[model samples]
Target: MSSLISIVLPVFAVIGLGWLAQRRGWLGDGGAGALNAFVFRIALPPLLFLAMARTPFEAFGQWRFLAAYLSGTAGVWVLVWWLAPRLGFNGFQARWLTCLGATFSNAIYLGIPLFETAFGALSAQPVILIALMMNLLLVGGSLIVLQAVSGEGTRAAIKETLSNPMLFAIGAGLLVSWFDIALGDGADRLLSLLAQAASPVALFALGVTLGVAGSGVRFGRPQWVLLVAKLFVHPALVALACWGFQADAINAQAAILIAAVPAGSLVHVVAARRGTLETESAALILLTTAVSVVTLTLLLEWLL
Candidate 1:
């Protein structure tokens, strides 16, 4: 219990502080966007690059682990996509939002810190491994779905996906590792500085976003469906995959934990950018994040 509290409390506290700051007007209007921009465009990319560059390529070869995790996530995504219309999320944008909420874990902002605190620096390996797959498959896939549904050409969707900074960083890092490229001490130091800023800033920014944008989102049936899919169905599928694939104990635990993270705030970002389902996405982020406090704590106690 103490271990769980030590890991979970500080993370949510930072988020709560950001919420309080926003509610109290400490950062003024649009302050959260500034912080989120820094996180998305600057801090997060470097952090991802460092994570990928530092990990051995052999670690990426954990095929069973990757298969288990991806299958679980992809399954949930597909399930939501199929069920959305029946659930009254009948529009293309609405279905896209449902799919995003179902599969998009808050891997970078919340998962990284939570796993690192619970399991130590070595925990980054599994977390980043999952993050890479999530970014590639879920994020890129969602963009394609949104663009396709909005009647954008395939070229446009492809271009947008290729231009994603996070995806670019992941690719660059993989290339660096593949070629055994070494950044000299100075460059390494620079990346370290930028990477160090990602977690606290992201958590705080998420809180601010919740305060500013999540205020009017009333929980309803759709919110309940999203929460259940994200926090329960997703992780259960991952656990089932672990069992079927006989993944290594540590890897299986990491996969399940990653699956249990709340919906990513990026869902809301994408909705806002596309002028679709913004309020519903925000509600999912806020509610899942709040509920995750309890769900993640139980998970930590069980897995740790």
Candidate 2:
């Protein structure tokens, strides 16, 4: 509880400040997007690169952690697929949104800040691991589904995944580590500075985005279902998977924390681009984030 009030509260408070800033017109037009773009393209890449570069090859061999996270994600996807139609989310797009809502997590924005606070530099290990899986499998897979559903080639999706700067960073960092390349003092300092900026800035940008969007969604049965699934069911499944896999204490806690976060902002972005379930996706983003405060606090109280 003290951990929640001291560390976690301040983090969410930053997001609240971002939201308040947006509502008061302090962020202006397109500010959040620009900030997010900076984090995505510049700050985070170097941060991630340095983190991966510093991690030992042995740490990346945590197949149990991957298995646990993947099992939980797969479970959610199957559960949602089977239950969505009965719950009125008919058609492929709607059902996919529901499945996405349950499985996808705000791993980059809200996640990084929390992990940085709790786990410090070690936070990057699980982050790099999750990013590799989440970006390649879930996010890229979504693109493939979209292209396939729309009668296009899936090759483009694979290319897009390969071209992602963060993914590029992870790969580059791994190569450097493999060769034992020396980055020296200047480069190290530069990366540290950039990585330090990624967390707070990302959280602020997230809050502004929420404030700017998702203003008109009404909470209903589907919304409640998504809320419960994302905050509760997903976390529980991941925790169980971690225990079954005999993950180390640190990995188990990290996996559970990531699972307990809100739906990914990317979920809403994908929905808007595809012109389907925009309102519902927006609503899920807002509601899950708001509700995660309680869920995460309770989780931290136990996990920490």
Candidate 3:
């Protein structure tokens, strides 16, 4: 409990502060978008690149560990999709939004900060492993969900994912990692500098999106169902999956903690772009985020 609270509360406090800042017009209305753009286009790329670049490929011995973590996430997504309509969500809304909630975690913004606080630099290994899976899902699976929800078929979705700048950066970073090229000192420093801006900007962007005119998420039965799935069911399954895969203690804890995060901020962005369940998607983000502090804390105490 202490571990989860220690991590989730402070991060959400930062987000709350950003929300207040936006509400008070301290940073101006456009500040959030600019922050998001900076983080997504510049900060996140360098962060992902540096993270991948620094990982000694030899440490990636436990392929099953990564497999279990990702497979568990996908499994939960499928469950959410099947149960969403019964839970009061429409088919399109349930499929995409449930996936948005299930798949991509706020692992970068929230996970890095929490992992750093709880376990220090050593935690970066598991976090990056999770991030790598996130890259794959965001690039591949997110598009699939959008297409399925919209009944738009595969071609348009593929085009959008391929053309996404953030996905392109992820692909480029993987290439650098695959080739095992060492970054020069100056280049390394530059990457470090850009990477440092990722969290604040990402959170602020979320705040701005939250404040958008049509972006308010309403908390009704359907939203609560998604929240429960994300905060409780997903974490429990992830823990079992991690244990089944024989993940080390730290890796297991990281899996559950990462799973405990609310829906990804990108979900709102995708929801808006796809024009499917935007309000419901926003509601899931806000509600899950608000409730996760307690739920995650409880999970940590029980699991840890």
Q: Pick the candidate with the highest lDDT.
A: 1
lDDT of 3 by residue, 1-304 (tens): 5557766677667777777777777887578777777776778777766766676666567566676678778788888878877876666754656666666677866776666666765456677668657755664567676677568788877776566565566566666777788889999898888877776666666656555522444689877877878887787788778878888777777787888877877777677776777787777778877787777667656754
What ranking of all candidate models by TM-score puts the best one first?
Answer: 2, 1, 3
TM-score to native of every candidate shown: 0.92, 0.96, 0.85
* Candidate 1: clashing residue pairs, number: 0
Of candidate 3, the 10-residue stretch with the lowest lDDT total is 209-218
Model 2: per-residue Cα lDDT at residue 69: 89
Question: Per-model C-alpha lDDT, please?
Answer: 0.86, 0.84, 0.71
- Tell how far residue 95 is off in model 3, in angstroms: 3.4
How much does candidate 2 score in TM-score?
A: 0.96
- State each model's C-alpha RMSD to the native: 1.9, 1.3, 3.0
Better of 1 and 2 by lDDT: 1
| Decreasing lDDT order of the candidates | 1, 2, 3
Summarize candidate 2's per-residue lDDT along 224-247 as a digit string, tens digits. 898888899998999999999998
Residue 193 deviation, candidate 2, in Å? 0.7
Best by TM-score: 2
